[model samples]
Target: MKKMLLIFSFIIFVFNLLTAQEKEKAQPTPANKVLSKYTKEFAVSLLKGVDDSMYPKIFKAKMSMETIRKGRNPIKFVYEVYSKGSTKSLMEIVFPARDKGKKILLLDNNLWMYVPDVSRPIRLSRNQSFMGSTFSNEDVSDSTWEDDYDPEITDEKGDKILLTLKAKRRDVAYKQIDMWVNKETKVPIEGVYYGLSDKPIKKIYFFNVKEIAGLLRPLDMRMADLLEEGAYTDVKLLELKELESVPDYKFDITQLGR
Candidate 1:
């Protein structure tokens, strides 16, 4: 009887050990949970006007790019933008007769420009200017932070949360970005982009907050170059719409000319 009792006790101990191990596996690690929360918040803040749908969201907008500089007439270009989700977009110059039929395509991380005069689309670097404006190809492209950046909350002030974002891959335009977001609305108020040297190269401000569709988003975005004096670009969204579906071919490079 003593031997049987001892054997039963050993069995119970082993079972308890196994159950504890299973519980540990089921619970998420603290580090991972923290990172996941930051990522979710960053994604929501970055893609403000987008819906939480598996399908891509489409936005149609009239964009006015105005460059503020000294000794040069304030250059303005009007464009019709078609954006799909946070990965693909196409912009066509509409008002300016000289630039009509010119198209800019953002497919994944690649940017291409198709001009009526050029036989084929010219691949553009993310750092390149968008139509000679202060906005870079990367700036105009629609992309989510979760895919390209890893974010962490560095500080929480009264009404804002400061987030530091590091690029997950080298292909990203900016190596690092420091952003201040509204804690209650999850709207990005300001962002500073840093180069590989960890120095700020550009700053962006989000303003004119309003509700479009069901999401609250900033209607105006202004970017200022840190190195350039009195040079900045302001982009205002005249119209925005979310689409139910966008055909995949619209983002294809081959269809850019059409």
Candidate 2:
């Protein structure tokens, strides 16, 4: 009877050891490896669905801006953004031609302040901030993903993959960006922007993930300013339409005056 008890104890010990080994083997190490490959795929999916027809074409945006310091109703504005490539961009705010009107034109690397009372376009620097918001003309005028950045995978985990992106042109607003892509969904979960100082300038959090045009994408983004303790920016995508056959001439800087 004592010998049988000893045998039973040994069998239990061996079973526990086998269980622990299996658990260790099941750790998500392989999932991390698969995530790295999906990171590149996510980047391609985002770029491919961005409606190329919008490129070299004009699109209308109904936007509102409110001064944070003053408690006032948000100022409403109607504007058109046109883009062709990295070198060219044009923005024209329409005057009371219809519903909302305040006409201003931004062309090429310069801004043209258009006041109906003034006769000609006033040249302004691209460095000027837009409506006291974090975005500048350089940020607004940036073309698609291809023109702005070149991304490479830096690190990966079970459900997270890190990407490091470098600005392709000197005129780009940010120098580098570190993006985190979700493994299962293949979408960007977060992005960190670095400035010329090689320090983190902003961190963008993506939420409300959804599948659009057969691709998973973020519907809302919140940006935290790393320089300022409590300052942040929120951008909500109201709509995303895949357009076709946007004309090239519409995006030209020369079209701004017309």
Candidate 3:
């Protein structure tokens, strides 16, 4: 009986030793491997630049939105977009003559749409679809990605840096995003937004970089819906001006269509 007890104790000890070895193998081996020198702070600063390279802080932009889907004619709309800081924005549709004068306001993560004849402003969520396009309301809204995501530099290619952004909170539109940025220009090259299950939900590419508002920025953005093949949206910036500031009342829900 004593020998059997001794044998059982030996087996338990060996099992625990093997378990510990497995756990050690699972942990990152930074000491043994040459790690990337880029720190979190550096990653954050680059991301902030990438955000500004897309749009200016206080500006009014004229853009066109076109949505293409399989077995359907492409739908297009033109708009004037007003933005202030990182939390407030207003988009007014100006084309498709019949749909003109419609406005959408984004304050923080909340959205409100005002139609020409509607009595009240319709409340919307930033996570929902924006005007039937593949881009979400948050995508159209003025938001600081650096605040919502914690960025990590994963790779550096010839002229681009690849970053893996993890959502800082659960309520965000994407759980993770793999973004590539042009190192010299600070303009985002492309990104793939992933869901909570790590499934790629959308892919976005930036093009047509030019000097706008004293900064080099991408004038055209394309968002492809990963779930729906051949379904995508293109938002092209027609006009942009960086202002000192935008009027406060322009973002008021009650002042949507005014």
Q: Which candidate comes out best when scored by TM-score? A: 3
Candidate 1 on 1-258: residue-level lDDT in tens?
999999999999999999999977554312212334456566445434122211136767777888887778887888887778777888898868888888888887778898996889999888778776777787777666666677777666787877777788987888877777777777778888876655677899988988775666788889998878888999888877767766887778888777
Overall lDDT per candidate, in order of appearance: 0.74, 0.55, 0.86
Candidate 3's TM-score:
0.84
Candidates in descending lDDT order: 3, 1, 2
Query: Estimated TM-score per prediction?
Result: 0.77, 0.60, 0.84
lDDT of 2 by residue, 226-245 (tens): 77775555555454544443
lDDT tens readout by residue for model 3, 1-258: 999999999999999999999977554312222126987788889999998888888999999999999999999999999899888999999998988998988887677889988999988876789888999887887788986898888888898998888889887888888888998888999998887666688999999999988889988999999999999999999999889988899998877757
Ranking by TM-score: 3, 1, 2
Off by over 4 Å in 3: 1-35
TM-score of 1: 0.77
Candidate 3 residue 197 C-alpha distance from true site, Å = 2.8
Model 1 lDDT-worst window of ten:
47-56
Candidate number of the best lDDT: 3
Shift in Å, residue 139, candidate 2: 2.8
Which residue pairs collide, candidate 1? 86-142
